[model samples]
Target chain A: MKQEEKVDFRLNREYCKACGICTALCPKKAISADDEGKPSMINEEACIMCRLCELRCPDFAIRIGRMQ
Target chain B: MEQHVFDRLMRDDKLPHMWCRGCGNGIVLQSIIRAIDRTGIDQDKAVIVSGVGCSSRANNYTDFCGLHTTHGRPIAFATGVKMANPELQVIVVTGDGDSTSIGGNHFIQAARRNIDLTVVVFNNSNYGMTGGQYSPTTPVGAFTRTSVYGNIEPAFDVCRLAEGSGATYVARSTTYHVQSLIKYIASGITHKGFSVIDAMCDCPTLFGRINGLGDGAKMIAAWPEKTVSIEKAGTLSADELEEKVIIGEFVNSSRRSEYTEKYARIIEEAQRERADLK
Candidate 1:
């Protein structure tokens, strides 16, 4: 994969409420939730950069950006 | 970084808003902020006014000028502020109950006057702040705490009501349609006269739990199935459109004169008459 095609995805732990919205909304299923319901990027390479998770995140916990 | 754009506009000290998990108020607030950015409006000149409700807590999170007014009175206070200084761009962020129940009269009156204010009503269908009581916008046959046997009252079509009351601009959008929601809100912000953007939100904790609508994601996923764009609705028959919520702009006209500018003209004429009489 090209370096420029990579997307920066990170969940802010301090801001997250473990609502599981990011994992649920990702069309590509690139994000996954743990047993505690906290979300993390499980497939960074599969991300299409659609930004659905970031835009629809109720808590604004998920931040997605393009890597330079 | 792009993160600073949002950070500079927000009071990070108030991080992690007090709303329940998966509440749509946060999404609505974010859309409003993004719309303000889209309009290129001066942050210092804009004011966010809100009435009492779960959605009314939005002003506390922003760094711009804000007024967390009493229940059902945000529009009245915003009117007073606009009348005093017409230069300020006023935006009202209110809930369904806050705008339709106690503030119903003010809401209609503001539209009638064609004031230069953008009113955003976060319609969660029920009164989330007061324990899922059936609000004026709550759909009939829906279960609410006040309507244990299901709500018999018909819901208010917010856009139609605003258009009927003479709002120059009116639109309706759901939280799931983030891009459209942002565009509608941005257009509302730029509109000169009274604009009402009815934001259909989800109170997942109270309303959804009581109605068996599943969780946050499930409720949002159902939006596309429940609503149809106005253009598409025109092609569908009445029977086919039954029980479907129509989304998109209903009215956008700038024919009427704005309240503040007209008032200023009246004042100037009165002062000129006094000078001639002297």
Candidate 2:
């Protein structure tokens, strides 16, 4: 059986402005961005669940929730 | 942005606000929503007013009772709203150009009266909406469309102006300090008298492009190096503090009665004195 993830990092693409702040500020570099600046999950294994991306994102498009 | 918060505070139809890419308006709006939510003020009782500017358009995004007034008149309109219905929480969202240029008198007068209004000034230094014209808060030697050879005029500090104009609560925070910005705005909302929160933000497409400051993320990254807290600011020499933006609350006091409350008292006394005539 596959292991469950400890946390969830969600991005609402419809609301994202492609500012790339989350990708730039992510401590673990787990998030990457496309050419136009839209962010995407790159390596989920290295996640620290710090949620700085959610806190600092200008557009409020990112959300990280800790799982029980 | 929690799902619940987004659903509760924002206008879903307006998803992905029209602000420029990497603009600081979105961050400021988010901070405001969180702050208002923290204060637990009823959305109906709270009113948001704004003037003409990129920042002033913040009214269209919120789920609060709002008034998008004409250029440089949101504060005046808010004053009237507060006077007519003292029960409402009046919040004025203004830009540096709107508040310090044509509306300068209204901004200072509102503070002088100690009115119950929470004014959040988005000081991006340049007029972003109007082709990056240098505004009253544009730092000296900064490049703008109008300042082709760099600005020669000194910048006006909004926080200092608010403090000197008798504002009961005054705070200075950058969009970079999202957590502290939310706290200061929340404190301002709960405070009884005039509150002025200067939210210094980046104007990437305009201010940044004109000054060669790179994009939005780079400007936000520079916030830490450019800003100093009040405690640290006191220790720094004038020369050292020249370019450093000071963050933190500068004033918090309730020494004087709120303008609306004072007006209500006068109305009561007037009614008593004219009882026989009625």
Among the numbered candidates, top TM-score falls to 1
Q: In order, what DockQ does each candidate have? A: 0.70, 0.71
Model 1 chain B lowest lDDT segment of ten: B1-10
Per residue, candidate 1 scores C-alpha lDDT tens digits across B8-63 of 68788898889888888888898898899889889999999999999999999998
Native-to-model Cα distance after best TM-score fit, residue B184 in candidate 1, in Å: 0.5
Q: Residue-wise lDDT of candidate 2 within B1-278, one digit each (tens)? A: 34567679878787777898889888888888889999989989999999999999998989999999999999999999999999998899999999999799999999999999999998999898888999999999999999999999999999999999999999999888888999999999999999999999999999998889989888988899999999999999999999999999999999989999999999999999899688
Interface RMSDs of all predictions? 1.1, 1.2
In model 1, what lDDT does residue B51 have?
Answer: 93
TM-score of each: 0.97, 0.95
DockQ of 1: 0.70
**What digit string (tens of lDDT, one per residue) describes model 2 on residues A1-68?**
12566567788888888887788878799899977678877877777887778877777798786653
Worst 10 residues of 2 chain B by lDDT: B1-10
- Which stretches of candidate 2 lie above 4 Å from their native place? A1-5, A43-48, B1-3
